[model samples]
Target: MHKEKQQNIKALFPPRPEEPQESDCCGSGCSPCVFDIYHLQLLEWKKQCSDILCNAGCYSKTSDGETNEPLLSPIKFSPFQLLSVQQHTHNTFLYLFQAVRANSEPDQESAVTEYTYVKRPLGISVGQHLVMRCSSDGNQNTVVTRAYTPISDLRASNVGQFEVLIKLYENGKMSKYIQNMKKNDIVEWRGPCGNFTYMPNSCRHLLMFCAGTGIAPMYPIAKSVTENDLDDTFVHLLFACRCFEDILLRNEMQQLSLYWNFSAEIFLSQVESTAESQTRYGECVKKGRIDKGVVIERLAGKTLQQVSILICGTKSFNKDMINYVKHVGVPDDNIHLF
Candidate 1:
């Protein structure tokens, strides 16, 4: 649970690999250095160099035209009305949201990273879901919304934005439409949806299991631990990926070692991933899987009641993990599904 939040923190204050000026990697002015990693991330050339680079992928053999594989497209679209939009990078876009209400809560808030800048929906109470009319490019403009445990921080004054992580799926319909969105494209949306939420004081220790693009929910939960100063508790996170290069917010994860004073100083970790397709689960898990046993070993003698688990991944991966934990005797209540 907390591991999810810590990942969010990483998304917030991502460490830059290099500073433009020859300063210390910690954004310090000190010039002399041993390893200039801070200098590297900032370099377009370093990325081109094969020796020092991190990316998320494998050398997939392009399917022969003769093959019967489903034609895959890497595009997705979920309509969000043109309330507003912000461009963070050439490739990154942030859309301010107007969603539907689910219910009401007295004190609904989320932990946010310094880098997490967003708009809060105006006139909407915390915990109240923002309603929107859901639709695709076609004729069916359905009114339905998924509940999102508000990931926006209270500090942000913009009463319109929420954080969302959308990755292109292979020949995905919604993915394709999102990639095609133009400025001022009016989109209709509804609801801060999802039953998955982090309740405070549920456990002193948390283990979060995640995969590519599954890191979104992990953020708000982890933030609660760090920002609220849950120092007595521990957060163990297992993030698996295809290769070490695919790890997101690599530098930001490093910052979590000493996070907000609450919670036990969070120790953030990731399973340095490898191409799972090339390696069987047994071997890959031993190497790239970020062994759950290792996590248990790290928590030696800790009671399962004292710790809760959160699992998020692809449909197939999630099934396998949930079963493994259940087989290990973890009660159903303690294991939160993502």
Candidate 2:
């Protein structure tokens, strides 16, 4: 009788949602992201589990008689308050946020609840990304979500705070919502998602090809390698932008280039090459798109066995970069597309 009851209870339990792979995301900021879908499925499963447990005469509550929930979860949204917003360019902004304590109590003086801040790292890996959720209308039915990779240092020293660089689009639904946000406003975030793994000295050289905001994920990995005293990986960053003014993280890139094992070159597609401009930015500034010749030049000294390639950009940009590297004999296994 006990064995039969166990089987029946197990049969009533809902199947857990399968997490999506990194390759499942096209990096195009699509609505209802694969992660988003998985989160919804997970929430449904949790609800079903609660119902099943109660019906089966099992303990569904914690020792305190309250429902148990994780402080942070990759599959669920958590409330974070915006600490500050700094505009980087006409369209780009850097936002800093702090996670709000989920178990804060109401103040004694009044009915208002006091919000406490959690002081700890966000638990994101060097190359992982997170999802941000926002509602377009006052109604929860109309929601918009986007994925972003934080550029902040995820070390324990910088606990309780995280930063993300956002490029606001003219007609983007999430952009509109973000632009109108104020300090202290609560935002829903869930993550530490992505499949890029990095180990010290995993490869002798790293060739990073990124355009526009694609640098978000690439920056952290490059920074991690450069900052580690034991990591001997040489990083060659080929960044493409419309003009010098459009270069995101220009100052950060310049500082990174000062490292012995790091080098960066900027490709300006819209700006014409001039003696003055070249002098200001140095030989690292090239005037044209990153084409076959540029790729060949960058790969000239590096051998196939010593190099790994990382590419992030628009779909066409990623496609072209892959073709360029493959044409030069770099295998698909050595290339990672973000």
Candidate 3:
């Protein structure tokens, strides 16, 4: 069965205009089962953590067999197995979470009050995924979940805990849930899910592209390049948004440009009015709609191979940007969606 638009777009919920009205016929009654939503969320989590190094199973259950002996099973899985299960589990969890939310409108003051850890954490590496479970809110009611790359060099710092900077989505399900979390509350989280891992050695000229919260993974990739002294790489990032307010991590991302090899540019195409009829940020933000053609013009003449484009945002935003890239001749393989 196909999932509804609402359930498929996890982590990034649609705006009011995007959401179907309550009268649209069904929600809790199988229109889009909360189970499906939870699964989506869990799928994302598992995909990233699938690369985690596991020597033991997190859960060991006593099983009865034909032999009737104490059936002790050694746990082992290829990266493929782990990733597949991780992905499936995540999707299931994501869908299920909706049910939890619908059934229980958690108090806005609670953070991660419960905690759970996987059996074994992986030793993350270049092209590896990292998931961080942190307190996302100031209250203690709900657990806010988001994904990020571990910025610390994997070899140098085998940090036990992963860290991801989260920008509170305005009243977002997960964002609002996290913003109100109290200290000591625990949110369950697992490994790196994105196929967007940056290869430090593979490319030199990096054209890192982003729009909004999508900037999270790019930060780690850029940091890895600079901090590890990958000077051969010249970085040019084109971040888009309506106004400066919709922008996130401006100061931090700008600082990355200070690196001798980095060049960063910001375009407010639709800040207030559309210079052209077909615009993206202007209408939506200032007055126009997002035009991938303009965005492509901004990224021409770069080493697409060396350049890793990390696009993260709401589902529509990311999808539109992705389709734009393919339309403009960027090899499907070259674009990395975080």
Candidate 4:
């Protein structure tokens, strides 16, 4: 009987994770690195073992024989149905996903027979991102995963929905999968994963640099700060794109700019400034790339200690922005990359 008990206890232990090889890392400076994922998995395994010991081999399981999980999790993916899709630009698309209810039942209080569901907020923090996975059509074994930050307002009431903006690359694997998605198609998502934390009024000023769809993470933080009545963080945003039409979230940015504390400037690298373009975008649009001069101008009145820097873009763009900021005396600790 003792020997059987020992075997039962041993069966509850999960296999230990193997450390990732150096070659496994793409070295693009991903937020949750392969090493980071391994560490999180290790911590989860330890907790599971501890729980098993405390419960004396008993474990809780839902009706489907799976552990009851949260709407979003770092360890497991949850299915969300594609409620709608909108094309924002030539290549950018906005997707809205609704959480799939688990074992929903009809409400007896209502005269009509319909399933009533309680909406839950996505619970995404200001600057966090989520990961999505897709499998190739022909080969189910071929899976591609990418990280995206949602642009939905975090302060809004619970709606059981969230939106993500994606730019379809010509030859991107994930882009191909997303482009073919239809309404009601199910997608697997897991997240609210990121290292950066934004506390209300944590800093006097926020200097953000983004290009293309990189504005995803920066938008939420800026929106939260500007909308809050008590938070007085000044936001200075430098957005870069090929042309005025290429700017993602143009209307939303324009709206946010109405706030006294929020200011945004767009850098057009490819297009020549025309009379109509200048008139429409006004003084906020510049006809060049974001260089050291622009960085200096944004940082003119702010002290280094009270300012926080945020950067999100392609590899080269991120490198350039980081170098530009560091050259201007901003310390490494104050800079955050997403």
The lDDT per prediction is 0.46, 0.77, 0.45, 0.77
Lowest summed lDDT over 10 consecutive residues: which window, candidate 2? 57-66
What is model 4's C-alpha RMSD?
13.7
Could you give candidate 2's per-residue lDDT for residues 172-246 as a string of tens digits?
989999999999888889986876666445568899999999998888888977876666899989988888777
lDDT of 4: 0.77
TM-score order of candidates, top first: 2, 4, 1, 3
Candidate 4: 10-residue stretch with minimal lDDT: 53-62
Score every model by TM-score. 0.53, 0.75, 0.51, 0.73
Alpha-carbon runs more than 4 Å astray in model 3 = 1-122, 125-157, 169-171, 273-290, 303-306
The sequence of per-residue lDDT tens digits that candidate 1 reaches over residues 135-183 is: 4645576333333333444322123445443554457555556666665
Candidate 2, residue 188: CA error in Å?
0.8
Candidate 2 TM-score to native: 0.75
Error of 1 at 334 (Å): 0.7
> What is the per-residue lDDT of model 3 for residues 30-73, given as tens digits with 9 covering 90 to 100?
83554445435544544433322111111122232122211111
- Predicted candidate 4 versus true structure: per-residue lDDT over 171-285, tens digit per residue: 9999999989999777888887997766545568999999999899999889978876666899989999998679898888888988999989888898867346343543378
- Measured over all alpha carbons after superposition, the RMSD of each candidate to the real structure, in angstroms, is 21.7, 13.7, 18.5, 13.7
